[model samples]
Target chain A: MGNNPHDAGLTEGPAPMDEQLVAYLDGELDDESSRRLEQQLASDSTLRDQLSRLERTWDALDELERIEVDQEFTRTTIEMVALAAEREHQEEERRRPARRRRQWLLGLAAIVLACFAGFAGTWYFLPDPNRQLIEDLPVLQRLDEYQLIDTIEFLKLLRDRQLFPAKTEDASTVREASPVVAAGPSAVNREVGAGVAGKREYEKNRARIEAMAPGDKRQLSDNWRRFDKLSDEKQEELRNLHGALQLEGDREELERVMEAYCEWASDKLSAPELSHLDRLLPAERIEQVAAYKASPRRQFGRRDGFWDMARNPYGTRWFGRGVSGSSVKEYADALKTWAGRYVADRAEVLAELLPREEGTKWKAGLAKAPADDPEQVKSRWIYLVRWYLAGPKQDMPIDGEDVASLEALLSPNARKFFEQIPPEAKKREIPVGLRRMIGFHFQTGQPEFENLIAAEDLDRFRKTLSVDMEENLRKFPSAEKQNEWVRFAYFQSKLPRDARSSRDDRHSPGSARPPYGPPSHDGPSGPRRGPGGEPREPGDGPRGMRPGPAGIPPPPADQPAEKR
Target chain B: MLEVRDDNAATFEELMLRYQNRVITFLEHHTGNHELAKDLAQDVFMRVWRARKDYVPGAKFSTWLFTITSNVAKNAQRSRSRRHEVNLEGRDSGPLGVRPLEAMAQVSSGQIPARALDRAEVRDVVWMAVQSLNERQRAAVLLSKFEGMSYAEIAETMGMSVQAIKSLLSRARTNLREVLEPYFDFGSPPETSDDADSS
Candidate 1:
């Protein structure tokens, strides 16, 4: 009997005949199993009844299969299959070239890499021309210090002693020479003109300096290149004066002047100005004297001050450090207001200047200009303002007609500002705003020579450079170089046409001549001396060495400052 | 298949003609869209021709052909669902001669009679019931009844076990009986009385 629940009612049970009946209906079973199931179906009425039911249910599903496809179905399917076969063959053919091209590219890359590797290996062993320039960076940095030395012979003596490293092949031969006692013929001219006490000071300092280690001597040599160019006696006088300043007593007026010379050197006063400092207004002279006074505490005697001078003498660090916190907040607020006004103005200008579609493109490009950095945001706004004022040529060629046309576009105050500018400045197609900056710098007497403009104004001025000029400037794009260019532009305005024509000959790109003018601003005492050399009672030097009424004060009761 | 693999176009045409209606019928029952069924059937034959080079005949040509047909139908249904529209009301011309219900229902008076529908109406009722089964059950029932495939053959075609095919058909039968029993009169189906009596 099959163990079927439905058949259980007919014969207590049948041995799994229900599933076998389904298998028999589907023809899934082998002949033996099928025949057996059929025999069971014939003999057992109940099992036979179950098979009949399965047969009827299965047949009923044929009602779903009644769909007779259209007569065109077969033909269409064959056509499609044939078409697909042809397409696949063509597709394979199409892919063959791309596969070949990819393989070719890979092969080419491998060959190029091999060639590069071989070239790099060979280049590593060749001599590099700029090697000495890179190695001498420390010496070049200390060039201002070197300028303090007055006697070339004394420098040669030091070079012979191996205190200074040879900077070139010619210098190397001098390093091996024996020291001689006789002063060279230029000795008379070498008098630093620092009077007798200054002479004594040099002898005294020489004793202590002579005792210093070779490395310490080398460091001093590295810093004082100008000292070598000094006339012989001036070198001796400066050496003596450097020693006397270390003493805490009175010095002669001559020693004071020599002390002032060293101070000017340390301050890195530009070369042309350094040579003429003595004749400068007492205010400028006062700076040279204060530079001496500030030295003992600011640099020579203090480690931090020395490093500060070594790393950045001009205080250009201000560019990155920005102003104090309160000023930053003020600048930030001002920037926000300025940006808002420019954007509003830009909308009307863009609508007037461009067709609607192109206007939207312009708007999108301007939108991508960065706004996060206040300087960059100000630059972008300045660019847009100039674009509006200068019209299509953002950079108008410096000519009177163009300048007048640009001025016509400016506000009343801006036009009035340009009206006051010198006729010479009007001839250059300089941006109106930059002309204002230059005029303000000259009026202020060029305070902070390199950093003549405020940081915000400097950012805007840079955006005014011709695109080509701006690209050329990017090669040496340090904050210092940018300031140099700003300073150069101001000086360029001052140059006669002939001088302006030879502008590139005046200085290298990085160190253009400082604006040709007297120094101004800030000194230790009352108002800084006007360019008119006014005299004031001298203050004690950095240590307490004062220049008394008589030339040299008698040595103080305290054991005389150490003499060699 | 061997002749087709040898690049015999005539042999391939013969094979396609033999199965075209069967494939279309299976797809029609699966998708309930005669136009889509026709499209899918054409794609199935296209694939069979493309894959002819890789063909190795197994148990039955119908099994292999219907396996491809089953896959094509499922892929079409999946894509159709993603397209997010289903025309359950049948085609504008009615799917494969199974007239839309509005027309079919009009032939009968007011309420549908308890008695079996005529040939056209029966086909429509069966198609609707077939669509009601989930995809797997629908495939199982169609392959089993229309192709007369044994449980093993259906299992191989549908990628399921023989036991799974049995359960699938069992469940499908239960669902069809529920939806159709009202109209079918199970034992005879009216027109097949001789076959019922013989059993």
Candidate 2:
């Protein structure tokens, strides 16, 4: 073996002969190399013997069994890929909101800069006196109202009195408007013009002041200067009181309440009683006010006037009768009943609108509610709706039908805009999509949905409705309902020209014709027509009239027929 | 592969079907364990799936796949070495650091009766001979022989230069010849200890 060429070659580091022979066997060598190796192999018996052994060993590896994975392996591999895809999709979904928030922040920054530029331009042109007035505009606008209420504590007491009647606006609307107020501590630093919406309101007020007569301007300026004279803490308290009143709806009602409280406090309370009232906490002050009303010592011949002033300042009854304990319970009960009925009527629609898991949870909650106790059921439903709505909007379940209807309603440009959204987001329910579209439409004014209705038809629709779109939005009982109606109107607006013309031709002289088409009398509970056969106001359109194909009513299950 | 990169499941399944057996056979020969080869083959395909998104369509898809296979096999070997667990199917060590095949060779060469070996026994002898090579040598030889990969393709898959692959295959073939020549020349089992001693 030592004398053999193969044994000598193997003893050395990779011999060229061994590499050539292995490459030749593996067909890795070029033809020239193979020929060279073959010549060497024929001439050298040892090299030929070495090549044969390599070939035999390579061939012996063929005895290793062929591996065939079962169908289960293929199935599992596919499942693993699918699971990975879903995880990636969910990760993308998780990242989407942060991206959207960045976009929203960019948009908000642009708006803020534009507003700042406008304000800077105004300030640059304004005289010193007018500039000071502009600086104090928020406080000046409510100067008389704040003047009547000396302290925030007194304002809190008056609020506790329930003297200001709650506005008829829906609770959801108020909640949507005052997020800072609902969030508590953050609301403290959020002055009147701190945010985008507040800035717009501030700009509107500024324009109103700019247009004011000289006498009115002078009066407001004097009020501002007087407000400026107050100590810093007092000024902050007054500003906070104004903010609190603003956060509550109906500032005019609050002003009346302030006036009544001021008049009643000065007349009814002795000096020490007034001092005592001021020292007490809010709840204690409320109790003290009730005590003063009941006390014979302070009871003058105007006891009836005291009761009238304290309980019902404005002759009309409010949600609760008075600040009395029983009346507070009544108010709570009334609010619950209203919320419960609202939720119960729209339960199915709301359920469909929630995410699958949340919808299931909501249904389970409703199922578990005490059937014998209606109040408990209503409270349970309210809790479920609130909990579900408080979560992220991306988690909201979208009804495919609603998305389809909303897409159909979009104008050509709007449809293009909708198509530009990711496919993953296109299936989102109407409220989110409609709100986005409406925001975009207003921001850009590109007639995204405007062209769906002709000018004359839109004018007719607006005149017949007797309110602008903003007021129409306010009239909806819930945010979801508002979106639903907007979606419905848009859908109706896109009806074919021939269809509308033929429907108008068939319309009787006394019958109301909606701008989309003639009202569908075939469906039960079709929209109510006005006296002169005009379309009823938008919010007044029958709650049951869900927009279906060609403005027909959807199935009964989808229709929340009960009034909000 | 491009279709797989675009998240087409059917194309991925088809690719798996076309390559699964070959991958498993290569891993089995590389690892010398059937069950582990099946498991590692799945891991190789999973790596393929994960890497699909970043897969550039330049190299042959098989080259990319076998590259993943080589890494996975190397990692499995490294971990098994760390665990200090002897791979019983491909046991290279016997008494006194001598391989079991060397002992069998000695036994067959001695007066110990040489029984008529069946096809399974020949396969086992061949498996022990292949396993007697070092990890890189085993991979190079198995890929070149069973996978029918060229030296350049094997180098690409193993992340080595072609010259290195040529040298590797030369040394691997020499080792295999040393281990399998006795069994090929005579009816005796191969000597697995001499290659270990030489390396």
Candidate 3:
């Protein structure tokens, strides 16, 4: 989400801060921060003049507070009027199905057309699944050169025989899972767990994000402190020149502060550079430095703190906001392009009897997705992600997409997968296009059975299924995954366990955290239609309508309308 | 008889009700206009509503609410100035602290009237002073002078190092002093120091 952060803290360059003035005004020093400000006020006419103006503005603003309302108004006056309007509109939703159907058709068609404006109206997309997640291609090549098909065979055998050779370190050390301990009637059971080191990384980043802005506050105090420190005569001289150099976002304002400081320092230390030093530092950097310098001592350091060299996303290696690097931009643009596809890339094919212009109308047709509401937004995003993941719905907005745009859109989810992908499969992201081979990453057959499963995948999963599962379990061996794996092995174990073993230990140990949840690209294709709206014609001018973004399933697939 | 943190929603709602009118009044005073004040006040509640999900019981909620409100008011001021967001370096408060918005998509079709200054002065000179502050300094001043928060409380709410809080409050005061030098000098209270202060 961020870029290289060299001088990131200096977003506006260093501006000016009158430290003496700040110290004098706040009286935070041993004599109170304002002691310094009072001292400077005696000598600095210009700084004193600026203070006087601020005092007047505050007075005028204070009078602005006299406006009053009727007692204890729990709700706004406008809500009553809005509520009436809302009622009137809700009644209309009952009678608009026919009109909506037509509109939906037109909208879907239009959206599909808009998406394919680049592809000359060809609705088909053939995203080389390999090309989509090429963040680490060498890893893919390494998997190709070693351990592709035989691994899956071993996995199946392991599961089939229930041969669970859990490492001794893992067997006893696997943390036990506890059920939610209800605390109240309608109990909202909350678990405030600091997630493993990974989630902690995110939390740290988020906190740092929260703290960064207020740094600007100290800039003012620093300037005030500087101003308060000045000789009375010097303060008067600086203030007379119009003490306008006190804004937070602009650092050049510091030049004036620096000028005053310079003039005063020149008198005090006789260093000529003291005057122009503000010019060299710049307003933005000065603001950053002044802001950081003015703040109190930090207790947290790089070791156990928010941002250290190891994980600070805004480290010097990263490019700052401007045009600093090309490779990063290329990656960023690729990411954005992928993110865009997730929003609206898939198509919905309606009956040929349906019109073509309103394919994407379903999006806007969404029951009033008002921008101001977050609950509505959160609900919508969840719905969208689910609908895409679940499958192409007959009622969903598949009316106008050509396959290519759908491919472009669907690719982002794959990229998201890349973002959250486990390291074991990290090596198999890229496909080596040698001999037009298909390398699908499904099925765990024997080493010789690798040829039996002629994959269209680079076989990333097949290459490291056991190893990755073991690692993931090692990270967080939750009872859910373990139990799921146990249940699955019990069903698949087919072996008659010694015909007399203990009833509880019927199924011998198998791998914990079985790979049960992969998006099913299997089974017969769902109902399909082309531009001509032919009923059940799969892959004609374009491929079948796939789920738009990430085909994530909704929490309750049975009742899609009911939120989880 | 009861652990107060049990129903945070009730507590938070109580906190909101207790401070809602006070905050609106503060905004009106700060902006010198009631309508803008109301809008900012509404925005403040919207934040208090969302921040509920992140609420931790051990900490005081008022401090958190004040921080959120101060950030929202300042951000609203910036967006009103010119829609392009140069997001504040610190993220103590702001709606987008949740996630980045499609800020570039919405273009201003000139909602603010272009009124020429009566005398060769700047527009919304008060806003210029506020907008000039870094995010934290502005929030600190808003909480202290406008929201009437004590320094130690502000530190807890802001989650800053006290020295940092001191610098922030001091800088804010200095800026206010520089801007309102012509006004009254009724030195309200002594500087807040943690060594001798408690709830």
Cα RMSDs, all models: 46.9, 41.9, 33.9
lDDT of 2 by residue, B4-103 (tens): 7876655676688678878887897777666788789888887887888878878699888889998999999888778754443322221111122222
Best by TM-score: 2
Q: List candidate 1 segments past 4 Å from native.
A: A1-18, A29-50, A92-564, B57-59, B82-84, B91-117, B185-199
RMSD of 3: 33.9
Choose 1 or 3, whichever is better by lDDT.
1
Q: Tell me the lDDT of model 1 at A391.
A: 26
- Residue B23 lDDT in candidate 1: 84
Rank by DockQ (best first): 2, 1, 3
The DockQ for candidate 2, computed on C-alphas, is 0.08
Q: Could you tell me how far off, in angstroms, the CA of residue A480 lies in candidate 3 after the best superposition?
A: 89
lDDT of 3 by residue, A434-523 (tens): 000110000111122123212332243234335533333222113332222222222212112221122111110110001222321111
- Number of the top lDDT candidate: 2
Assess every candidate by TM-score: 0.32, 0.35, 0.24
lDDT, candidate 2, A1-564, per-residue tens: 434555555634566777788778878788888887888878887777677667766766755545556666666665665566556655655667765766645544443344334334433554553544554565665554455465666666666677543455544553322333322211343453476665565455567678876645645654665565466787767666756766666544555566456545543343225445655776677777777766654311221112111111111111111112112334334444444544454566666655678666666666566545666744553443343332323333345554564455443323544555555556532333222222222222222233433456544544543234445344322343334344434433433233233222211111111122323221211223557865543222122332222221222222111110
Candidate 3, B107-190: lDDT as tens digits: 011111111010001112233345445556656666665555666777876777765676665455444433322111110111
Best by the DockQ measure: 2
